[model samples]
Target chain A: MEPRPTAVRPPIHLRIADDIRMQIERGELPPGAAIPTLAEISERWSCGMNSARGAVALLRAQGLITSGRGKAPVVRIPPRRVIRSSERHQIEKDLALKPEAERGAIGEAETNLNMSIGAQRFSSQYDQVEAGPELAKVFGVEPTTLMLRRQWEATDPNTELRLSWSVSHIPLDIVKSNPALLDPNNEPWPGGTQHQLSTVGVEIMKMVDEVTARMPTTVEAQLWGLPEGVPLIFCRRISIDGDGRVIETSDADYPADRTELHFVTPLRPWPKRRQA
Target chain B: MEPRPTAVRPPIHLRIADDIRMQIERGELPPGAAIPTLAEISERWSCGMNSARGAVALLRAQGLITSGRGKAPVVRIPPRRVIRSSERHQIEKDLALKPEAERGAIGEAETNLNMSIGAQRFSSQYDQVEAGPELAKVFGVEPTTLMLRRQWEATDPNTELRLSWSVSHIPLDIVKSNPALLDPNNEPWPGGTQHQLSTVGVEIMKMVDEVTARMPTTVEAQLWGLPEGVPLIFCRRISIDGDGRVIETSDADYPADRTELHFVTPLRPWPKRRQA
Candidate 1:
């Protein structure tokens, strides 16, 4: 027979938090529903006020609820998700060969956020820096090699919060032939990064996306307006040439609570009759 | 002009945590080094013991340090990362056509964990369940559509901790033609899922991986042996046949601190000489 509960227990605060979390998960406390008060929790669990406070804190830290000093905690209403699909890689490459008029009509900012660049302020800054040890290793370049680093950001003017941000780095030798590529003023750069490379007679044949996640630091949270418990999705995208040479690398961050990173893989078909 | 610090303080504990977090980032306090004690923190920050305790708790929750009742908290030494790459999708598809002897020689456990299946305990549980509204929508089937649900997991025998875990779902009608597909006893199937689907005349020509992340629940944290601050990377992989029909959907989670998801997208080459 299975042993009964109450013999061994986790910390009182953890138990209390778990109970509340279950209620939230089960829809007993639906989104926007208020969490129980401290007094009510203490009474329900027969725990001290300290345990009750800790339970609430835990819930907030877990991103299950939203609370402020003057407001009662409520179940967090999930934000609308934004899907970033790998298919865009092909689309961007295709755009590079499209008519200039067609290429100028589309911008990643619009496709990514469903908001036009006109609705948000866009900025691009470029500078040259030594690749240093880590970046040089990634680019297979010497530590003394200079690289052109470009930072791009789209921000909501009203909130002064970033809607999208990324940094791209390329070895100076690779793109120095195209002066436009080194100038920030030339961006929006109709056709995006692929076109920029195309202008320099470079053709990207492959891209690799490396993804991971981690909790946001306090400054990151404040900047992103993130609630507690949300993690940031980080992706480093490496664009490669036909010769398998790494040409450029770009890194970006997305709020996991509202981002869905989609990767699509197309597999080669098996030989006829192989299925049998 | 930027304002100076000390004018706007974000809680004493937050300040303390930020200081230590910076130290960790800068490698001032290398991994495995002891964190400052409550007494030291309090003295340095000129804060009370409660604030000091809160700062330490915050660091632990951020997954920057590890501590237990009797042991001093120390900067966490990151675990060895295991990479799960999308390239494996095509590898599995190719393996489905290989000779039985070669296919049988390889198991996912070996490829995924770099360990032989003989070194761990594996389990496969089969069950029949209604697709329900959510899953029905995903598969474009009725709510009551019978689905074959299979849970696969591998565990280290000594620690009883999970090495890998995933749940797969396939509409019963799609795989019922092959009875072996529904039987748990047929596991260790020669070429894994791709081959199993082949027996049912399902050819997965495409696969889409959807990934997100969040803090693991208290129970999940325990099962995964995750320290504080680590998040779980959740992936839902959907397999689509030639006609773009969804055949199988699988969900799995990986500890973010020790997992890297790699996605490779091969771009079509631009027209020759179009690079100019």
Candidate 2:
């Protein structure tokens, strides 16, 4: 279909922004290089200073450039993010019987190395609640049954804004066997969820992560210290045991700019073909 | 770590905004319900009108509420998005051999149900370029060899903003056997990419989608009409043929609020134990 006439006339600022963006992508203006000032762009592009400023603003919003009050805009060099692959599930399962020192030395949690927890305010809330229809289906239990919900959050000490957050749900009946599981102080469970489940006779044989993305609420944005145009990655991980029972469901969110989720699928070798 | 007090306490508006946000999450105010007016909020919360207005503005920017002139802000209900599963690769392969009429009836484009192609401006550009070092490694071809790069975008009819964007790359030599493959007009090709490649004796045996999320820059926010704190989902899909040769690479971007990606992994049945 032909485009609507209203969409045909690209705005002046957008056209200007696209030109500068192309130059950056083509490496004519390299990362960390200062872009032309509004006055310079106005003179070169025969546009008003406001239009030039708008172009710069547009570029900054797209994360192509960075600028502060009274500072010239410059191309941004994004930091490298570590990839946390789902394949780690298999590795964690194999490490269940290993000593704590050996497990700690693996350095899996420290691998990506984005934010440091030491500089944040951490909180954990533990509560028992009836499972909703969604959780009940996953847990293979009645909706009225009580489930344990643990919420964890870390706020930036300086801004008092949220840095990270996650919530995990487990059947109350299973984890109640160990009273420590209900204690908020017992968090950061040394070996992570795998070890926590092992204490409850749950051997997780498989895990599936469903991933999506969405705009954060106003309160969420402030907590995450997110910039404009950035989205949050939402993942729901379902863990199943050897008996095929769903053991737990954990939901986590990551800021898109600083998080990369990787999934590695190792294929089984095809059976050898019979000789003709 | 404890949160440090701010030198200038955040304005009352921010505190009020946070409180209202909590109310929404607690189910006091449900999605799609009208938010209280500035006057009402100011009176109820014992805050100034400016603070109330600021809180509403913050909610709108965060995508929690939607409003316009003369319209009171209402809680936003995110639209339901279609989940595109990777397991469809095998299904698509089987459908490729069907008659063109049957294939056209099945329509692969239906996957994007919430995004209407007719409501936006569409653009597609095709170019022949030498494979860069990274792409050359995947294609197992010389860097000097030509590759076809295709970029597509849909812009909103009213705002002239980006709605959907993607780019695909294929070795020119592999697809050039069919001249039509070079034409952008043939997009939404019956049976999708697999069928298009089949014309050249290329059968995609496997496909992998690498997914990540990040915040968008200022310009991207405007283009996608993303609210503050929204993240974008980035996915790179790699297609490999029976010979284990990478045939095509396609990258797609989806607005976080309206995209869900599903992946299914089928496990092989365990081999029978050897007779004792």
Candidate 3:
């Protein structure tokens, strides 16, 4: 009896996907370039249409391409990550005394160091809600006290993909000193949050940042265009005033793979007697 | 020109997926419980086989389910995050002279407190490699000098999912004082890395942690079992000895969704002036 032929091992779908991946990496499939149709892929790879479709799905999962109902898959070009460092805490504190142009140049919102205003859509929402238990504890306020909640998000208009997101909360009584603080139109606030609080006579003497990370949900993944195995960075910034009263709290999420969080900690000199 | 009945808006696939998601959240599908098979799902949801398959795939991508060839998908149980804080630096420094059992309970690895040993697999690899240019500058060593490298990882054995991961590097010449330090078997060393360096006549006077976050790639997402929209927390820790010489550097990654990075910065009181 003739020995059964070994199963033909090289999966056609994987081979096709590899070829496209290589092309993308080599710049043959530049960002925004249309990917081949299922029929075209099948003919090019000499494989079944299902195999071609599978290859396209593989590429999409790898964040190499994107597809929709009427559109062909296209190479995905991710935006540059913005670096928000804890070192900037001190820098922002110092910059508060500077002129508008100077402060704007060194602003926290100026995450783009190259000074290029890339094409991105930004939206800010403002609302007044009672602080939740967790947030109340951080802000040293009653859970029922009204607080101003501001949420901001920037998206890539072409893909409707989120680029950056953050939420800030301040006790209404604290920011009511400057009614402008309650307006979303006043966003992109010059000098950022610190300056906004300053207008209300709140001086943030100290800032503490708590950070953590976790996996994203399916819906979140689509919003951020995140690939599997990547975690999200969660940061909560707590600000305190001169009397050790918690004044403001803000929480933000960042994609871990592309973003870099920097923290600068300065140490005091050891006592002369204790020096070795 | 009837607008084609609005294209029959609803799809069988989305309906099936949403129903399963609701079931999972409602605890009908408990952690580790097998998810319905494509055939079963097709019958239960009154959808086609392909739609059933799509539903399962959606759940897997959301991190709610895990599947393998020939096996039914199962609900995924989220793992508890171990909290490793910068405060461990001061804790270890103060506990150096304490007894073994006491020291072990308070050192760096103590963060694994609530974790089940059987649920997670821990591995450490030790190697000696030449210091790269970037590391050489920080360690004040020549690029040609060998440096000891230790990598630690904790993963879910069944799913092969990473829970925690970190890498530490030290100049070989500095740690060579204790031969046991070169052995991977000596890991989980009592008193942690600080004590290990002490055996080599190195005294860490300061430590710095730099942190950031970004989106994860496809490969990274799978390894960490991350969902979409999640960010990753990146931390690089540098240790400096008495002479302000950089002695060790370690890098760690954390999933932002489930992990929290806490840093405590201690401030010293201002010096009192002597009476004239």
Q: TM-scores, in order shown?
A: 0.94, 0.77, 0.68
Q: Each model's fnat?
A: 0.75, 0.35, 0.35
For model 2 chain B, the run of ten residues with the poorest summed lDDT: B267-276
Give the C-alpha miss distance for residue B134 in model 1, angstroms. Answer: 1.5
- Scored against the true structure, residue A200 in model 3 reaches a CA lDDT of 69
TM-score, cand. 1 vs. native:
0.94
Best by TM-score: 1
Q: How well is each residue in A100-147 modelled by candidate 2, as lDDT tens digits? A: 776555643444345565665778899999998889888889999899
Which docking band does candidate 3 fall into?
acceptable
Give residue B13's error in model 1 in angstroms: 3.2
Residue-level lDDT for B7 in candidate 3: 38
lDDT of 3 by residue, B153-182 (tens): 888766677877899989998889799999
DockQ for candidate 2: 0.26
Candidate 3 on A1-276: residue-level lDDT in tens?
344344445578877887887888778989888888899998888989899988887776555676565677777765466677666676666565556777566545556332333566788999999997878888777899999899988887666767778888888998897888888887667677767766666666777778876556555666887764445677788877768888877888777656766654543333344211
Per-residue lDDT tens digits of candidate 2, residues B68-186? Answer: 55877777777677676665667677667767877776755455545565565778899999998888887899998899999988776677778678889999989998999999888
State each model's TM-score restricted to chain B: 0.95, 0.77, 0.67
Judged by TM-score relative to the true structure, which candidate is superior, 2 or 3?
Answer: 2
